[model samples]
Target: MIKLEQINKYYSLEEETLHVLKDVNFEIKEKEFVAVMGPSGSGKSTLINLIGFIDKKFEGKYLFEEKEITDFSDKELSAIRNKSVGFVFQNFSLIENNTVFENIELPLLYNGSAYTDTKARVQEVLTKVGLADKASKYPKQLSGGQQQRVAIARSIVNSPRFIIADEPTGALDSKTSEDIMQLFQDLNRQEGVTIILVTHNPEMVSYCDRLIRVKDGVIVEEELVK
Candidate 1:
């Protein structure tokens, strides 16, 4: 459902043009669970940013489901992002002040759902993430795993075409990380949710269908998980 051709990205320092991604090319098919891994400063983040539609200043061709993303206006891109992509970061990125239901409802509201109409959809996702009873709680009141579950729920509440999970387990304990990974695996298997996971932990790749390794601004390896 996603394709990148000859992708190249750069950053400008005072006296140097730093190339971040070099001739990167890959395609993620529908319902595929893929993991992107690299050391620090390896450009995986930059690569995912472009894939997630957050960055347009690059030299490459990005086609989403056969449509050229580059052709979209900024406003159009934002709308596409709101509807097509779900993002889960290392930090939960939830509003500490809002109830879990409120946090998940934000996306629906942004998508034009009315306040009174958001409860059912929000409850549906909360139940899917195994947080059905915690919707009334606040982020600060939950464990790290619970908070991350809320974040994942919020991401999928919009029924995005794909989810970009950047270090979703980075902040959790090993057991909690395993639980989160299992949740992702279940979601992909049962719901056919396409996930592009960016993680530093090699162990995490065991749960993904494919592994993509990046190094020094290049995609160094692509292999099936087996």
Candidate 2:
């Protein structure tokens, strides 16, 4: 579902250019679970952003579902990114003031989904992520795990084909992290949702089927974990 060739990313520093990713190349198939693992500053998140179509300023070839992403216009890219990809971040990125139901419903609202259909879809994903009872609660009212679950629910409510998560469990305790990882695993296996997880935790990486290790902005190793 994804293809990258000769991918290169860099950032300009005060004195020199910091090469974040150098000649990166890889492909991820449909329904595949991939773990992007590396130490801090190794460009794991940079690669994730590229794959997610959120960072398109770099130089490379990127294809999604056989179409060249680099060739897309900004509006075209935005359309596909919204309709095809879901994102979860370490910060949980939920609206602090909005109720869980409202937060999850925001995407559909923006996409102009019909009120009835949005209601049904929001409820479905909420239940799937064990947040059905917390629909009316605000993010601050929920614990960290519950908030992350809400984020997960909001991400999948639109039925995105790809889930790109960065440090998904970084803020949670070990047990909660395990639960979150299991949720991602079930989504990958049962729902056939492609998952690209960028994590520093070995336990989280174990949840994925493949691991791609990054260092100095290059993919140094790839391995099958399951």
Candidate 3:
């Protein structure tokens, strides 16, 4: 479970301090698929960063799995990001020169895994994402949908509890986006991985169990779709 209470975030500028998130309170239960929707600059990305453990500077009480976030050590936080959370961005963040297998192996390498283990895990995720045959190809050789599949493969190789996707289908066509959303749904329902997606597309948001809508730095609505 994840809960945020009275969360507030701000950015400092030479002339002004821009408040980005305000009193953002919400609860995401285990195995729930949630979508965060808003227009540009609505703190959607900021909210994703916070949930993904990519941002540490903020004011609020953040509790994850019944533990207070601020009490965790740096190493523990790193473990949370590595072992408990996965992230997929709008832009597929795969390495340009690396083969698909190598890109998926990167996270395990960062986690200090042995070469044999990394290869096994990468191959497993490749098969899971239906890209087992393209492991030898580079990012430039794959289409947008394929590249995003590679990104998703890399994200799940760690078997994270929370898959935080920020506009994951933003760069794809409608058909391809539907495929990706279906994949997310499969992961949530079958694997029971809790998903928090940040997207502007209602078509995409409709795939989720609930929508947490934001506007001008505040949560304006939350609706359950399923």
Residue 72 displacement in candidate 1 (angstroms): 0.4
TM-scores of the models, in the order given: 0.99, 0.97, 0.96
RMSD of each: 0.6, 1.1, 1.2
94-186 per-residue lDDT for model 3 (tens digits): 989899999999888888898877877888889888898999999999999999999999999988888899889999999999999998899
The most accurate candidate by lDDT is: 1
The number of the candidate with the highest TM-score is 1
Cα lDDT for residue 188, model 1?
97
lDDT of each: 0.96, 0.91, 0.90
Number of clashing pairs per prediction, in order? 0, 0, 0
Candidate 1, superposed: residue stretches over 4 Å from native: none
Per residue, candidate 1 scores C-alpha lDDT tens digits across 36-136 of: 99999999999999999999999989999999999999999999999999999899999989999999999999999999999999999999999999988
Minimum summed lDDT over a 10-residue window in model 3 is located at: 47-56
Per residue, candidate 2 scores C-alpha lDDT tens digits across 126-161 of 999988888888999999999999999988888898
- Give lDDT: candidate 3, residue 86: 85
